[model samples]
Target chain A: MKKILILVVVALLSATGYGYYLFQKPSKDIATTKPYLSTIAPQLIAKFGSGQTSSSSELLSKVIQVSGKVTDIEKGKESIIIVLNEGIKCEIILDKNPPFVKGDYLTVKGIFSGFDDMFNEISLTKCYIVL
Target chain B: MKNKLLIMLITITVFGAFAQNKKVTRTGSVQFLSKTPIENIAAQNNQVASILLVNEKQIAFNVLMKSFKFEKALMEEHFNEKYVHSNKFPAAKFKGSIPPSVALDKAHNYEGVEINGQMLFHGVKKPLIIIANIEVKEDLSISFSSSFNLKLEDYDIKVPSLVKDKISEQIKISVATNYK
Candidate 1:
């Protein structure tokens, strides 16, 4: 009976521990995660710019790797935004600041948020510089 | 010589009008707060974008639901997957115009500007009037800010009874954008 009680107590404690861990789980680190697909910045920008709103929803939340030349870099309070090819906006949320300067050819992996018609640019979040 | 001068004057006028009429930005900020005794949840998205048509006194904002990052992963997941169904709709947008009475050409601080427009969210389009404080600087860059409250039921966002009490029905939204 004592052994059974000890086993029950351990199981209950472990269940609570696992629940706590899940509740405190951090956002997905897409930098190390394998990308769904790869493409260049201009091509992605063109597709989304042509009023292909449906495709944006399809790619939403999926990690993608995009390569382009950095055109503008806007450093915000929380993260660094590297504009690619004068179009795509890759926001580095997890990694606060990246060392890449303007005109540097680079590759980033991040979750595709979607196209913003206001600016006509593709948006990425939780971006991590891969190359 | 007179004709050439007239042509030059026309060209200058067109170019100056084009340069001063529009301003846009991609790093606009939008924040939402849900306060209840059980929890006070707030999320801000700096990735949002806005456009200011100074000539027409028109303003519009676009923000992806997935862009709003919450402090807790579970909360973010629930917000995207269940609460908003963001994958289907992806974004909430507002396309509206400022009152015609305000002079947009001159640089001045305009307060309590009523923006009348339609807000499209959760695939539902509803008429929304946002009160904003707009500052038009000498350079023609605009600093626009507004805060408003929205009821979850107004947009057909139904929270299940299981967590209904925890989440407030009235969600406060704030927007700040600098158009350059």
Candidate 2:
């Protein structure tokens, strides 16, 4: 009887612990998570270049990895947005000391935010250089 | 005849520049706050793209649902999957124009100017008018800011009855962007 009671108590404690853990869980860490899809910069740009992409786009909200060449770099207030092949705007956490130029080939990963037709670029946030 | 043609060409070029004076920004910010007695929820997205047609006094904003970052992972996931359905509605957009008399650039500051436009969100289209504040800096950059209350039902965003009190039925949205 004592052993069974102890087992019940142990199960209760674990359940409570798990509940706490779930309650305190932080947001997704993009640096450590695996990307849902991978594509070339130009291909991705071509698919959404029309600027008419709606909810039907398959890559919305998915973390995607892209391989491309650097075409432009913009320094924003908080992040450095590196444009891949002048199409994909990959935002990095470190805004200072931008390490990219006009012709560097690179691989990057981030959440596929959306296509900004006004700016003619696809945006990625929380980007990390995969190297 | 050659001198007259040259004058006509110069006039056309000047008119073209005046009509197409546009300003665009990619690193715009939009933030929303939901408050209730039980809990106050907030999220912000900085990857907003906005364009200002200066001469026409027109503006538009485009924001991706996936870019909104919440404090808690589970709350954000639930917001995207259940509330807004980011998979089905990836973006929320607004396209509107201000009145010609507003004179968006002639003055250094203006407050409470109304802009009427159509807003598309959660696959629902609704007419929206924003009361905004505008500031023209010495460097000729313009700063626009606005805040408004958005009703959940207007966008067809339904919340479960159990979680109703935790989230406000009306969310306060704040938008700010700089065009240089």
Candidate fnat values, all: 0.51, 0.54
Q: Please list the residue runs of candidate 1 whose C-alpha ends up more than 4 Å from where it truly belongs after superposition.
A: A30-34, A46-58, A72-80, A93-102, B1-13
Across B74-149, the per-residue lDDT of candidate 2 in tens digits comes to: 8888889999987677789999997787665664787898989999999999999989988877767788899998
Instruction: Give me the candidate number with maximum TM-score.
Output: 1
Alpha carbon lDDT at A35, candidate 1: 89
Each model's lDDT comes to: 0.85, 0.84
User: In candidate 2, how many Å is residue A129 off?
Assistant: 2.9
TM-score of chain B of each: 0.91, 0.88
TM-score of each: 0.86, 0.85
Model 2 chain B: ten consecutive residues of lowest lDDT: B98-107
Question: Can you write out model 1's per-residue Cα lDDT over A48-82, one digit (the tens) per residue?
Answer: 75544777677887898999999998765467788
